[model samples]
Target: MISTSKHITVFEHQAIKLNQEIDGVLFDETRLKALQSYYGENGVPYYSLIHNGVRFNEYVGVIQVGETIIEVLPKADNSLKGSNEKKRWRDILIDMLFAVGIFDIHSPSNSSLKLKSNSILDLYFELFIKEVEYLLHNGLVKQYRKKEGNVTALKGNILFGKHIQQNITHQERFYSRYSTYDVEHNLHSILFKTIKLLKQINTNVELHSRIGALLLHFPEMPEIKVSESTFEKLVFNRKTQSYKKAIDISKLLLLKYHPDVSKGRNNVLALMFDMNKLWEQFVFISIRRHKEKQITITAQTSKYFWKPESGYRSKIRPDIVVNKDKADCVVLDTKWKNLNGYNPSPDDLRQMYVYHEYYNAKRVALIYPGTNTSKSSGIYLDPITSKEIDKECSVISLSVEPKIREWQKNIYETFNNWLTFGNDNVQKNKNASL
Candidate 1:
């Protein structure tokens, strides 16, 4: 058994900790190389590895090494009285889900499973098992092509081979696998397989046992060992989409570990998701989810700023774009930093200016995480020093706290206020409706 006492201390660079083993799901010297190669962090590594799984590009979260197991604690804490580690982790996961563009994944009325503090895997497992259960109960299946070669019978298509003798038959079956859409796909099957592996690594016997039970629930869903590059190539339609809706949580497990037959029982695989990019996506999704229907949220468009030098285009991509009637109206960017009563960084301001000029946006906005102590509501671009510009800029703070009850309403009000002046669609539609 891998020593439960082993601890690898490291730092979270850009909210990312590089794992030594891309597939083994452990911490070692290679992790340092990964850190140096990926993040260029030269100082002593400050992160602590508690177990096997893909080292996370987790949220503003910390991993604490325990005597028996590891603990994950989120940086965002609530003012709630009697709050424990479990509550903090729960709150953090909820915020992550929100930022991951699945805030409304489950409606308020239908939420059933409970959050536990014992293991972070519990949160992911519960979500995955529940979603798998939902898919099973859903009674809907999808079809896709599954190729096979067998001499048994002619099923899909026969590849006529000169090498095939009467006794030696190599019949390739190019048949559609009539399996359930959710079964053994890149997303769901990986979860099934990961869960099977988790049962082995889990220190919590009860939890792992439950995970084992959950695996049985997915009888038809064969556990698949798929690489990140390979699985990403599959497509899901409207029908299969619902079946694997739990993919977000499933992704956490898939990213953390991959099954390795070479290691036999120790087959673990995990991947990384940049929290910065994830947060950027979440901010836009939150805004888009609440914005007026007439207003369209264009995220990470391919359009980049270009200079006259050598016919090469500079790849400067803004985080979000608001379009009114198919015309770019506002250009916005989200910064994960806490400015702490200071003005937006000069570089950030300059970049926004470039976006405003390139996109011809009337207004540009910079959004940051809103904490209790620090507040920079927004400062409009001064008309005096804007350098004969056609657009104005503002820096806005969004709440990172998960417990805020009116968060969506807060997003709507903030975003709506920002665009009210420049968005002709909102103005045109507002008067007609209200």
Candidate 2:
């Protein structure tokens, strides 16, 4: 039997010692081994194993080891370690994820999901459950599948060799193959696997009843060995399109889950996201949503930079590129870390410089999460002459707001204003380029 469930919350880069009791929760040996083995197999860099404990990296999410739950949350607000701060960042992370289309919840009624959920895992489980229940309410999609079995009546094509081999003794039975339309298919199989996984790892009492109902009502599908490619092979049409969201969440939950085969002590399920990548996506999507009709906002637009004598060529892609009226382009790179009253790093500045020259961008900026919303301008200096060049790069700090919509609006407005006026030198460069 499992021991009493313990929930521990830690911020990014925080460490928890193994074989120790803290905050009234014990980080026992079994749980630590489970995590260690998981990290060994996946090597995700979500956490690093230390001499005494594990330190979580920039990947923030929830991981379950047996009955123990570890929730690692993102921390951009400095070293303020408090429960209130944890809750605040947790909500912010979820909101950012929602904006970036990570938590693809389709239910109209679930718009306020951030307010009701206790953890990110709970939110995922609940969203998946709702999706499955919706499909069950409407009906499962059926498809034509070829099946072979022994039958009394001659239906489909019958193989004389197999018929004689098996049905010789019983002349009434005929082994025949036929195509029957049914709900059994790869999509349902994936969903069923996700349901079983949720049944095992889910600890939320409120979600238990809903999960049970899904298992009871959902069609029994063949168990499949799910992989990253398994989801890649799926093809959705009109009939299967409704299952897209559910299958997406399923793919995430099923793929990240690693079960404990030895001693069956701890099973780890990590649902972590790289804050840097998430920040980039969130900014791009937010701006795209509210940008002017004439402006074009694209993310990760790649351009071949260095071509080698042989093999693959090097490519450079900025996080976001905005083209205004197809005349001037602005590049924006997002970083999740706080600048803390320091100038941007030289490497970062150099990257922005390349983006400026390669993309011919009117301006480039490194966006950072900060307490105050502000922007600073800097010009590149000539390497030999020590004179300022016409090129300009700026650093913009955006304050995280309480509401996601307000935050998104702030992103669009701030980005729009920056693109319009820019710095004094950037405006001059824009006029010079035109």
- Candidate 2 is scored at a TM of 0.93
Number of the top lDDT candidate: 2
As for candidate 2, its clashing pairs are none
How much is the lDDT of residue 107 in candidate 1? Answer: 30
| lDDT (tens digit, per residue) of candidate 2 on 202-227 | 89888888889888988888878989
Q: Score residue 83 of candidate 2 by CA lDDT.
A: 76
The C-alpha stretches of model 2 lying farther than 4 A from their native spots are 1-5, 19-23, 78-81, 112-115, 324-327, 424-434
Candidate 1 residues 252-276, lDDT tens each?
5555543334333333322223456
Query: Ten consecutive residues with minimal summed lDDT in candidate 2?
Result: 425-434
Error of 2 at 125 (Å): 0.8
Q: Root-mean-square deviation of each candidate, in angstroms?
A: 9.3, 3.6
Model 1 root mean square deviation, Cα atoms: 9.3
Q: Per-residue lDDT for 222 in model 1?
A: 58
Q: Give lDDT for model 1.
A: 0.53
